[model samples]
Target: MQDQPLDASDFELIEDTLLKYGDDHSVLNASELDGYFTALVSSPVQVDIAEWFPAIWGGQNPDWQSPDEGKQFIELSVRHINALATQLAMHAQAFKPRFEQTEHHAQPLTLAEEWCFGYLRGVAVGNWPELPTPLAAQLQAIAFCAEQDNFEPPADLDVAQHRQQIEAIEAAAHALHDHWVAQR
Candidate 1:
């Protein structure tokens, strides 16, 4: 299969549709959606898409007025996720973690936080073993991103510092992917 990333518009459409149909309690925003997909594909255990879809989508197929569009969304998502898995597997160090860009009034930190939440969910589903010490420390850093909103940023953490944290999280993701692949 071709490994091209999904078009930005297509990604937005799928994310928007899922959000419209998802449970109110759902935390799987657009960035999380990608993270969840990556986790499913990288999972050591085989995951059945049929079962996984509903679970990820708040336990129901999206209530699309146009079934064809819903089907298209699924197809596109599967393809995009497959491409991600391919990249992670074949070129892990080169894998660039995808995150939602800050837009409108949204903060860049929010994107990182949401992406980390989704990524952690994915890692949970994969049932990864306890990571080695250095990797675990990196994972802890990523986990901290999930709590960004709850805690005030340190006075020393300026824009560049925040960006560094995000970059570290991305690097951590690559390391996590490598750890999983090595286990297989």
Candidate 2:
């Protein structure tokens, strides 16, 4: 498990594996999966991949013919999250959150919505205590992301506006991580 950034190939592999063996899990997209991982690692309460994996897989056992490959995936995922968490904790300003795709896609907002939903679910699954004011505000913003479903971008929100919203979400993520780290 190296502290390497997950590249596009890694995302493709993860998405393909989830499609094959996630037992119809909702986190099929890279953004949602990344968000879930980030939340798990940044959570105030401890969470293990062993428990989280089953939950993400919809409580169904992974149907991996090669268990070693599954293990590798889990290890890589944990390492990836650890790297992100470290970056967030050490250099918050330098931290650039990775979304699902690079170029503009048709489902950017929808993907963002799913990512927020996954992130919130991760927080809920943890043994989280009462959140601080900043963290709570961040949660509220993420909740707003979860509620968005319109395919058409709002007239007021152009591409730049949408990107700003995502930047805010990324900032909130870093803020939540900082809050939890300070608690420690």
**Local accuracy by lDDT, each model:** 0.71, 0.71
Off by over 4 Å in 1: 1-3, 103-110, 149-157
User: What does candidate 1's lDDT look like per residue over 1-184, in tens digits?
Assistant: 4467778787788778777777754544677777777667666665677766776665666677898888877787788777888888886665666776653224444347767777777666666678789988988987898676334455454766767888898888777777766777
| Tens digit of per-residue lDDT, candidate 2, span 87-148 | 77676676665554433444444236767877877787675787868678887888798787
Please list the Cα RMSD from the true structure of every candidate, rounded to 1 decimal place.
3.3, 3.1
RMSD (CA, Å), candidate 2 to true, equals 3.1
Note the residue pairs that clash in candidate 1.
Answer: none
